[model samples]
Structures are given as structure tokens and as C-alpha cells.
Target: MKSSLTTIAKHPSISLLKSCTTMKELKQIHAQLVVKGILNHPHLQGQFVATIALHNPTNLNYANQILHHQCHHPTLFTLNSMIRAYSKSTTPHKSFHFYSKILHFNNLSPDHYTFNFLVRTCAQLHVHVTGVSVHCALIKHGFEHDPHVQTGLIFMYAELGCLNSCHGVFEGVVEPDLVSRTAMLHAYAKCGDIEFARKMFDEMPQRDFIAWNAMITGYAQCGRSRDALSMFHLMQMAGVKINEVSMVLVLTACTHLGALDQGRWAHAYVERYKLRMTVTLGTALIDMYAKCGSIDKAMEVFWGMKEKNVYTWSSAIGGLAMNGLGEESLDLFNSMKQDGVKPNEVTFISVLKGCSVVGLVEEGRKHFHSMRTLYGIDPQLEHYGLMVDMYGRAARLEEALIFINSMPIKPHVGAWSALLHACRMHKNKELGELALEKIVELEDKNDGAYVLLSNIYADYMNWEKVSSLRQTMKAKGVKKLPGCSVIEVDGEVHEFFVGDKSHPRYDEIELKLEEIFRCLRLSGYVANTSPVLFDIEEEEKEDALGKHSEKVAVAFGLITLKGVPIRVVMNLRICWDCHNVAKMISKIYDTEIIIRDRSRFHHFKKGDCSCKGYW
Candidate 1:
């Protein structure tokens, strides 16, 4: 609108931008520049575009107005600004439409920065075929060699799980920066190839925090929890400052190992440094504490969070269910719904688990049926298993059979395994055999199925069938998985097996166990030897029951650690004898003992278990 643009020629760009603290101030300055006949000045216009696109923290609509409405003939800087804004925005359609403007309205060819922004937008949208077209545009414009552009392309392809294409783009980089190489590392890890990811990681001459985080998280995704913890320690020892991201991954490792002590240390580190507790890091802490036998602490972290995403609610709710707080878990689910958090399949899975723990048959049935009707979430195999387990645990084998037959999908191995466990609990050979038959029909003949069937027969005094099942297992080369338990003490994990006597303080632990046994006998702790049901003497049966892996792990914890909670991770379900003994140990020692067995969690406090003998 100005006739001669010279009134604002004395103003410096830096000071002018420094004056804009709000969008109103910025708009006023723009109007003054235009009325003063300096708005079209190249340097001032470029600064305005940059300020609108990158600097203006309040609103981005000003950029669009300046380029589309104010300037009939906008410069290259103006187009790039608008494009960059749209690229970072969540809704990217406007960004692409603006990119099309360059070909239609503007005669200016797209520069490397322009295409770089477009590539980043494509990555954010995760539109693969469209991204490939954008890549073709970059090639057509001869900006393919641009490092930032190629890096964007690499990330887009990597996110699409297209590792082969990532390899081509990565190999083409004449000199790769840390971002590009980390993208490649993450790409390999995404495909579950830890070895190749490590090879690429080791080849890097310099690794940043992002690079190290990629390695730790890759190991976790691959189910290498021990290796992930090892890498985190190495990263710390190498003098790389750990961030919240690394802390989350390490906490996840602790969750896998049931390493309560290590998880506590990570929590302390977060507090000591006053690092920002992002949603991800907070969710990880909740999960870690919950799995580590500290459900109260998990709840503490959960309630303290100002923001709760689906992951946060799901982990906290699921933790309660797994720890045998069925009623509390259900209540929290209701709260999550009232908070407007949509219940996904994972959330329903936790809800179903809570229903199973509390024997809420009618509630479970209603929710399972409503999964597709109300939530549009089709019931997966795990849901079927939960229903079956619920019925079976409630001593309703007939309903379990009916549910399995009604499943839209096939009742896979997990579902049948749940039914088998229920039959074992009720000592029902008829239904146990039926479930075992279905289990054998599946592709993976879970050895646990054979063992469960055998245990069921042993409980019913059908020794002949038990012997026959074990013979068949040997003929098929199926072996029962050895039961093992691990306990963490002072940042070190000690593993114990059934009848383990290999600890360095074996004599001392044995002596302590004897003393505890004497005290247990005085307190009328009658060992129920029904689980060791073999053609053995009473003495041998009692001995076998006493030497269970869970008991050994607890004894080790009591011997080494003092006055703190004892947490143990077991590879097999705790037998009834060990469960009873654990309750007595809790009451006798005046200490809490938490055990995570193959099935679910048992938090024993003052002779009372969280499961309440339901599991």
C-alpha cells in the first residue's frame, strides 16, 4: 500500500524481532512496516516471514495472511516459511497444498530448504507412497544429495518399516551425520535385528545421547532385557549423561528383570536431577514400580501425574489387576472413562484380567460381548483366554467349554492353557484331558500343557495316566521347563532353581532356613504335601515341597537383605505348598514378600496374599 518504501530503512532486523513479545505486537509492527512503505523491502520481508513461521510462538495464521493476502507477489522466503509451518503442524494437508502452489502460482523453483521441509512433513504424516513421490521431487530438483533432505527421507522410510529402502538412502549419503546414522540404527532395530544394529552402532566413531538411547531401546524391543541393562551401564560408565529417555528404557529393563532395587535407583536419579517427567518416562516408572512389587508406589506416581495418556492409565490399571487388586482396577477403569480416555483393546484386556481375579463372571461376559458392539474392538485371543480362565477358576468348567466353542477365532494354545490350569485347580481329569487334547492339536505343543495334565492326574491319584503322559512327553522330546526364581539384592541379581544349594552363603542360608522351619513348626505351619503327589515316602514329599524354587529365592532374600520388602520373579507358577509357606514367612518375619510367578502377581503381607487364594 506504500508508494515509496524508505520510512523504515533505519530499523535493524534483530531489534525489530526482539520487540515482538505477542502476536498483537507483531501484527501492529507489520501494519506499521506496510504503512511506512518498507514492508516489501527484501531484508524486512524475509525477517517478517521468518519471524511469523519460526519465531511467532502464539499463532501461525499470520504467515499465511502475509504471503497469501498481503503480498500479491510473495518472495521465495515467504513460500518457504508457509511450507515449513505446515510441515511441523499436525494437519499436513495445508502444507502439501501450499507446496503445490510453488508449481502453480509461483514461478520460483523449490530450493533445498523448501524440499527439506516437505520431506519432513511427509515423514510426520507417514504417507509412504506420497513420501516416495516427494522423494522423486527431491531427485527431480537435484536436491537428493542434500543431507537434511536425505535424512528426512531416511526417517520416513524407516518409520514405515522399510529397512531395505533405508539401506539404499543411507549408502548414498556421501558423509552421514549423527542423525542419519541414528536413523539407520533405529531402522535395523525396528526390524528386530539387534546384531546388525549393534554392528552399525559400533562402527560409528561418535555416538550422541540419541544414538545410545536407540541402542538401549532396540535391545528392549528385541526382548534382550539383560543386554539392555548392560548397555545402559556401559553408557553411564562411558561418561554419557543419561536423560529421561535412557532412564525410561532402563526402567523397562528393570521391570523385565523384576529388579526393584535398580528401578528405585532410577526413580531417585529422576528426582535428584529434577529432570522433566514426560509422559513416556512417567509411564515407564509406573510400570516399573508396579511390576517390581511396589504397587503402592506405582499408584503414587500415577496419581501425582498432571497429565495421563492411554499408556499411563493402561499400565497403572493393568498393574493393579496383575497385583490382584481387582476391585480397585475396575474402579480406576471407570475413572479413566469418566476422564474421557477411550478404552482400547489393551485397556479392556486389563479389565478382563481384573474380572478374572474377582470372579466377576457376569461383568466379564457383558464387557467381552460389548467390545465389538460399543468399542469397535474385536476380541483377540487373549480375551478369550481371560474368559476361559475366569470360568475355570470359578469352578465352572462347563461354561469354559461353551465359551471356547463360541470364540469367533480359534481357541489357540493360550486359551486352552488357561482352561488346563483351571482343571488342575479343580482336580478335574475329564475337562483337563479335553483342554490338553486341544492344546496338542495346536502348532506349538506347549510343554506346559503336558506338565499341567500330568499334574492334574497326579492330584487325582491317577498315577498310571500321569506316568503315561510323562512317557509320551519323553517320546515326543518334550521337556518340562525347569522352574527358576531370581531375586535382586544391592544391584545384583541372584538366581535360584529348585533344590538350589549353590549360593556362596549356602551354609548360612541353610542354617537360617532351618531356624525359620523350626519357628514355622512352632507356629503350626503344616506343610501340605498334596502337590508333590508321587509314589514317594512322606519325608521325601515334604522335602521336595520345601525345596521349591520360590521358597529358595525367598530364603535367599531373607538371609541377605534385612527389614525391606522381598521381591522375586519366578519362571513357573508357585505351588500351593510354597504359597502357604510364603504367607507364613510374611507373618513370621514381619516382612512383606512379593512374588511374580508365571501366571500373575502375589503380594504377601502379614500372612495375607493379594490374590486371596483366588489364583
Candidate 2:
């Protein structure tokens, strides 16, 4: 018996099975094992099961059949292998079937590996009760203190949004190792407790790439783009090996800040390190370039990619729309269909947005109906809002109102807000007032509605109504969101707020602004201060408009960054006055000025805007 075991262990079939690259090779080895009558041996059976179940192109059903039918006395290792494989598979619930088998086997018992995989399966399932039951099973099986098991529990609870449970599991460890500590940090970060995550990160004796990534991704996901970029800078200074994950996170930060220079550096770094341009990384590059006001580069990246997914197509399409190339966006949507990529809900949003920007009312309606008829995708609230915006922007207020009243679902704030914006653009005070009334009824604290209505009133020189709305806002404690703009120079982001004077070079920036306005005035630029809600003198309104956040950031850019385009990212929509000023500045200075506002990108060059006043 011992000699037969030794022969089976050293069999040529076993060696071939270990290195087999394809299912055919594996089956050939399996046939040889059966031909030698060594397949019935428990050790050989376990090895065969492991190889088949754990292979990259795994045959779990076949391995399961062999284990249950061929191996009469399967070992715990064989059962655990099945459990671990199924844990990562799409059918994670199948892992519980093998766990039950382990419990049924009188001679075999589950160990740390079984529980670790089981905990991960629970996380994948995202069932809180099942995760708790698994935790109890881990304790009953005497693996509650195992570091790997504990780490899995932390992750499981984090996925279930049970932050306290994760903390409890971490605190129960006698002396947590690096893996457990990192898991806790990830839990905090994943649960949106970034402050605690950062504190824990700082207190750690050592930090790895995973910990750094968790922190940076947490910041990015939470809309703390500045902090995300700052952390990326620190990660570089610490000599941590940058990977594709790091690049993607930093690119997201750059996208939010419109930090084109930093985004360019990240793209160059990926090339310098020869990192494989994965579909996700390629998509991020396209999005960053698009949002940073570089549509041509975005297109270049989109075309250069060898592999493209639906998300990649959507990003490219959305980038074109955001850059105010609505016709090009619609053209690409057709190309996407030709490439056999079915559009999802997000794809339709971009399509409708493209229609809205270019006033393609007929095309927007055709695509909007196609979403349901062709793709079986129901129009969501955002789609409805876009339809309203399309008609509203085209000055078809009656059609927009008809569409809003026809919505199957209750109209949301976005629909009314779109109508209000259109009213403000066309100076339709009656419709603007009606939209504001509906918006206020839906959301009394919507500062944007109040601000928009005030602007519409100010447009008609209705000072009493504007002052009344302001008083109502003050009474209701609805404060307008202050405008903020960010610009990057020398790879560092500079943020400016409305009337901001905190920058060290504020005096220099002020002087530069004076010079810029002088040049702009010489070229027939005038401040259109009708949008200002304050009932102040014309000179005071002009001064207030001049102190807007984007102008300050642009002034700083002119003073510090010469021979490069001035890129500004605003937290709100660019006013008419600022937009005109940017166009004149671009031509007078013979430079480009790109501003990404709340809605879309405005590329100012040679006294013209890419949006052509559409946005």
C-alpha cells in the first residue's frame, strides 16, 4: 500500500496536472491517473480536486463530481478547496453547500482556511444575517482569533456597513498584525469615516501600498479631491511603488480639480513605468482629459485603446458632450452602437445632455423614445430632466411644461430647476415664478432655486421682488452656496473663493486683474451685472462681479503661469459676465482659458467659446 502511494505521488500524470495550461491537458492527465488505478487514492484525489477546482479556468462542477463520486473518503483539504473556489465564484452561496459537507463528515472538520473562505463568501453575499451566522460559526470552530479569519470578518462587516462590528472584531485580536491593521483602516475608510482612517494610517508603524490606496480612494469617493491628490503626492515622496490603482485614484482627483498639468504627469508616469493600459485606466484617462478641457487628447486616448468596454465608450461619449461637441457626441453614440455595445441608462443621460447643449430637440426626442422601445430601458428621472432641459433651452417652455406634467413619476426638483434656468435665460418672469413655486413646494431649502429666481427677477429690474425673495431666503435660513474655483500651477492646486483674499500673492493677483480688465475694456468687454441679485449701484454690482471666484483664480493663473492655458474649475455655473470676460482674456492675452463649471466645459480661445453661449 505504501509503495503504491509513493508511486502515485511521483506519477508523471501528477506532474503534468500541476503544469497543465488548458482543460484538455488536465483531462488527459485525469485519464492517465484513472488508467493507472491511482485516482482512487485519497491523496491523488485531493490533488486532482485542488488542481481542477483552483485552476484559472476552473471546472468546479467536474471537480465536485469527482470528489463526491470518485473519492469515497474525501479529506478536509479536498472539501476546503471546493469551498474556497466557490467563495470567489459568482455563485458564492454554493460555498455553504460544501461547508455543510464538511460539517457532515464525521472524520473531517473545517479549519482556518474553511472559515476564512466562508467569511469572504458572506461578504460577497452582502447578507448581514448570514455574515453574523458565519462569525458565530468561526468562533464555534475555534478560528475566531485567527488573524486571517479576523481580517476577513472585518472586511465582511465593512461590506455590510456594520462599522462597529468591524471594530469589535479588530479589538478582539490579541495582537493585530499588519494585515488586520490594514483591514481595520479599510473598514473605516469604506464606511466614510475618513478622519479615523487617516488617524489610524498616521499611527501605523508601517504603511503598504494597499493602506495608501484605501486612504486615497476614500478621499476621492467622499468628494475630498484635494486631500486625495495631497495623499498621492505624499505616497510619491515616500517612495511607494505606484501601480495602476494609484494612477486611477490620482486621475479621479485631477478630474475633479481640473488639474490638467498633474493629470498629464500621471499619464506620463504610466507610460514611463510601462504599466499595462487596462480598460479601466484608459477610461479614467479619457475622463480626466475630457473634464480638464482637452477633448482632442481624450479622443486620442479613446482611439488608441485596443480594448474598450461599455464604460469606456460611455466615458468617451460623455467627454465629447461635456466639451460642447454635441454633434460629435451624437456621432460617437452611433459608432458605439455599430461596435455592438448596448447603451445602458448612463449612456442615454449623456446622449440627452448632448441634445440639450446643442438644442437638438428632435434628435433628443428620438433617442429618448428609443431608450424604452429599442433597449427596454425605462427612462429614469435624470432622463426626464434632460428632456425638459432640451425643450427649455430651445425656448419651448410650453413643450417643457407639457412634458413635465406628462411624467409618470412625480417630477423632481431637477425638472423644475431646468425650467427655471430656461426662464432666466429667456427672461420669462412668469414661468420662472411658477417654476420657483413648484421647486419651493418640493424643497424649501433648495438654495439654487432661490438664487435662480432672484436672478430672473433681477434680469427684469424687479428689485422689490428680488429683495423679497432674499428676505424669504434669510427667513428660511437658506444660504446660497459660495462660489469656489480651483486652478493648478506647477503641479500644485490653488483654490479661490468669492472675494477670496487669503492667497499670499493676493495683491499681485489684484494688480494682474486690473491690467486684464484694462485690456478687456480696450477690446470692448463690459461686465453684464444684471445677474447680480443684490440691489446695489451699477458700479458696486460690477465690482462684485469682478470679485467672483473664477476671475480671482484666472488672475492668479495669469500672474504665475505664463505660456500655458489658464484652467479654472468652478463650484457653480459661470455667470454671463465671467464667461464674456474669459473669452476676451483668452484673445487679448493670446492664450487659452478653460473653465469647467457645474455643468460643462468652456474652452475660451481667440475671443470665442467652445460652447458658443449654449451652456
Candidate 3:
């Protein structure tokens, strides 16, 4: 090794360094270089330090030791190598310490890479104080105009929530390139300024895939799912190919919109393009199909994957739970643990929900306790809400109230609603009133609470209180959310509001609905008009119950759909009358009727409901 060091000059030394894959091999070659005085070569030393520090990060300490003990004075290249490595190091504070050494010992000024790495580190750490100092130093060195340095500055300031400074740095650039513009787009999205992100995306001369995905994701992140889907269509029309990132964003939008057709199209694109399947894309696809009523397909994709992460299991489990397959969801969760995948918060959300759906009170209680005691995760509001709902649905009203009172965090509206609605179900007027009082204290204008209370009053023949509550609701302008249902027919969604005879085919729809009503009566089915909380005439009440949005959508589906199941998405909980009607219609038409309401999924088939009167 010593004889060979003399023949190995700088260029051959690089070749040796490239060939040396392990730290042990590099150390042996480095020892020979030191013995032959090769360590004094500036370029050779930089190459050696970079190999250990940058390429192989775990050996950064060894690289730092070599830089500290080097016999020759540190050159800019050598200093930058150490600084660059430390920038990405877990201990990024060490990068600043090395920079201080460069300034004090070698009198070498920091280069562009030094600032770039430090600024990114600051962004990662969210250390706004250090980021500001780095920005000041860049300005002092007159490198603020450097495209790469300015890009880092933009990212740092954006992450730090210093949008004004971020924009100032961006606008201050002489002529920003693609990297710079893309950073700005990501920054704007992070800052919750989707409008600004779209502006930047539109103004950019050359739109890359990153830019396209950033804009689409920005819209989705801001709850503008429609805009995100529209942007995706425009991207495809522009001949920009869709990748995994883009597909995930588009699927999210489709999930929010319940656009089953669009989701199917995205899945087809993935298969056609042979895109590499990642956990994120797989999870997104699973969630999309699950929300779109394609649980079978979601599971098919789930089982075909070779790799599974926590999110993968969570999506599959949650998808099953959402589709009213509670037992299957819990089974999949057990499978996840058997496969050595740890459950996350989202995983338990589905687990608890499955327990609630299937009335597994003991299992739900055990897992709820395990959340904190076993996994060391505190139960969040959503978890508590699910528990309250689980107990309420199980007719354990006392336990539900106890759970609400014992909540570490203040109970949300959904939790109270679950308890109050349960009170109504069990005819527990006292607890129902108590839950409504707390709800009113939390939010004064909650109309749902008033409606639930009125129903409770009406149930027990307390007409005086019901009337009083109705007057109060009118005085406070508490309007009930009008019930609406959407059914997708031939790739287009048709919506029907309660008592809405405004559809173009309203004549045909009404005629079919009447025919079905006659058939339902002939089957010895009676309309349960008990859900009409309002104190109206019996005939008017029956007519209103008959014209519910879901009933109309079902009638529409029977007339339009040939053999496929009728799937309806509703904006509110299914009323008792509507639920009964759906079961009867499913039997009468001899077809499956699936309705997803605000609370849970109801699959009516052959005069039986998946909810089993539990919902």
C-alpha cells in the first residue's frame, strides 16, 4: 500500500476513492496517502472528506476528525465539503460550528453552498432566528442575487411564516430560474396562499411536473378539490404526463368530490402508464375507491402490493369500516399487527369506528385504553368522539355521558351530537337536555341541537316545550341544513333536495315513486311518520316524509339504472322514514341500495339493512 501511494496521483486517487465503497477500505487507503504525504494535496483531501461526509453520512465524525487534523491549511473546497456534509447531518448545529472554524482558523469566507445548506437546515429546524442571520450574511456577501442562494432564502422564509421577507427575496432575484419559481410555488402553498401559488404557477414560462403538482396539491390542501381536479385536467390537456405525485393529488380531489368516475379514470391511467406503485399512491387510491363505494377493488389493490406501511393498512381498514364492513375492518387491523406494521392514529380511528359499528364494546374499550397506556399516544378529539358514539349506539347512555365528562380535552360538537341523538333514541329526556345545554354553551347557534331537543320533546308528547323550542329557533335564525342527496348516473351526478320536483324528469320520477309507494303498502309496510319533529298536520307530514331527497334519488335510480346498484350520497343523517323506505325499496326493486349519509353507510338489501337499526 505504501509503494502504491507514490504512483497514485490526484486523478488516480479519485479513481481509488470512487472504487472504495466501505469506510474500512477508505481508511486503509487514507493511511497510505498520509504516510506518503498525499494528504497535503488540497483536492485529494477535499475528495476524501466529501466521500465520508456527503456520500456516506454515518461516517461524518470520521470526516470531521480528518479535517480537524489535516496538516495543510484548509482550502475553500475542503471547507465547503465539510460544511456541505454537516448541512444535511442530523446535528445541523455542527455545520454552523464548522463555518465558525472556517472563518476563525482559515480566514475563508463562506461560499454559496454554505449559505444554501445552512438556510435549508434552518427551514428544516424551523429556526427563524438562525435563518434571518443567514439571510443577512448572504446580503452582506453580495450573493443574495445568486439564484440558488435566493431560492434557499425563499424556502426558509416561507417555512418560517415570514411571507413578506419570502416575497422580498423572491422579487429581489435578478432572473429566477425553474428551481427558484418552483420553490416559491411550494412556499406560497405552505403559507396557505393558494391564490398566490396559482398566480406564480400561471406566470411561470416553463411549467415542470413539480410546478403542476404543487398547484394541484395547493388547491386540494386548501379544500378547493374542484379546482384541483380542474387543474389536473388542464395539465393533461397540455400534454404534461401524470406521475405518482400528480395522481395522489387528483385522487384526493376525487375523494372529496365523491367523483367515482374520475377516480376510476385515475386508476386506469396508473395501470396504463405502468407508474411505479408507492405507498402514498396506493393509500390515495384505496381511500378514493373506498369513499367511492369500490371496497372490493380497494382490497384487491391492497392485497396485491408487496409492501405495506401503516397508512396502507389504515386506508384499507378505514375503507372497510366506511363501507359498513366493520368485522372485516377489524380483521384487517389484526392482520396489520400480525404483519409487524405498527398502527398509527388513523389506524385506530378506523378500529374504534369498526368496534362502534359492530357493537364490540369490550374490544373498543381495550383498544381505547391501549392508545395511551400501550402506545403512549394521547387520545385526540376524534378518538373520543368515536367512543362516545360507540357507547351511545350501544344504548349505554350513562357510559356515554361519563366518557364525555372524563374527556381530557373539551368535547366537540360531534361528540355532544352523538350523545344527544342517542338520548333521543333511548327516550332519555334528562340526558338529552343536559347534552343540549352543554352544546349551547359551546356554540350558541347550533341548530342541530335544537332540532334534536325538539324531537325528544315531541316524542314524549311535550308539545308546549316543542313549540317553545321552535319559536326560539326561528328567533335565533337557526336554519336546519336542508337535506340533499346525489346519485351518479352514467358518469354524471344528479342532486335532489327534499320536496324538489324540479328535475327535468320529475314527472316520470314522481310517477315511479307513487308506484313504489303502492307496492310498499301492498307488502304490509307502514310509513313511520315519527321522525317529523315539526308539529304539522298528518297528511302534510306524510307527504314531506315521502318526498325525502334520498327517496327521490332512489326512484330516479330505479328508472335510469339497468342492473347496477343505486348509490346515493346524502348531506344529513337518514330519517327513520327514509331508512324504512330504503329497505322496502331494495326488496321491491330486488337491487342493492347504498346510502352514505353524514354519520355512516347504510346498505339496504332484501329488506335488511347493514346498520341493523343501530345507526
The 0-to-1 C-alpha lDDT of every candidate, in the order given, reads: 0.85, 0.90, 0.84
Off by over 4 Å in 2: 1-130, 137-143, 369-379, 522-524
Candidate No. with top lDDT: 2
Cα lDDT tens digits, model 1, 437-512, are 9899894447888877878877776778877886787778886677888899999878888776888877877787
Query: What are the models' TM-scores?
Result: 0.77, 0.83, 0.79
Q: Whole-model lDDT, candidate 3?
A: 0.84
* lDDT tens digits, residue span 161-262, model 3: 888888899888888888889988988888999888888899999998888998998899887877898898899999997799999998898777667888
RMSD of each: 6.3, 4.5, 5.5
Tell me the lDDT of model 2 at 1. 90
Where does the lowest 10-residue lDDT sum fall in candidate 2? Answer: 56-65
Which 10 consecutive positions of candidate 1 have the poorest summed lDDT? 1-10
Off by over 4 Å in 1: 1-166, 497-503, 510-547
Clashes of each: 1, 0, 0
Q: Looking at candidate 1, what is the lDDT of residue 551?
A: 86
* TM-score, model 1 to reference: 0.77
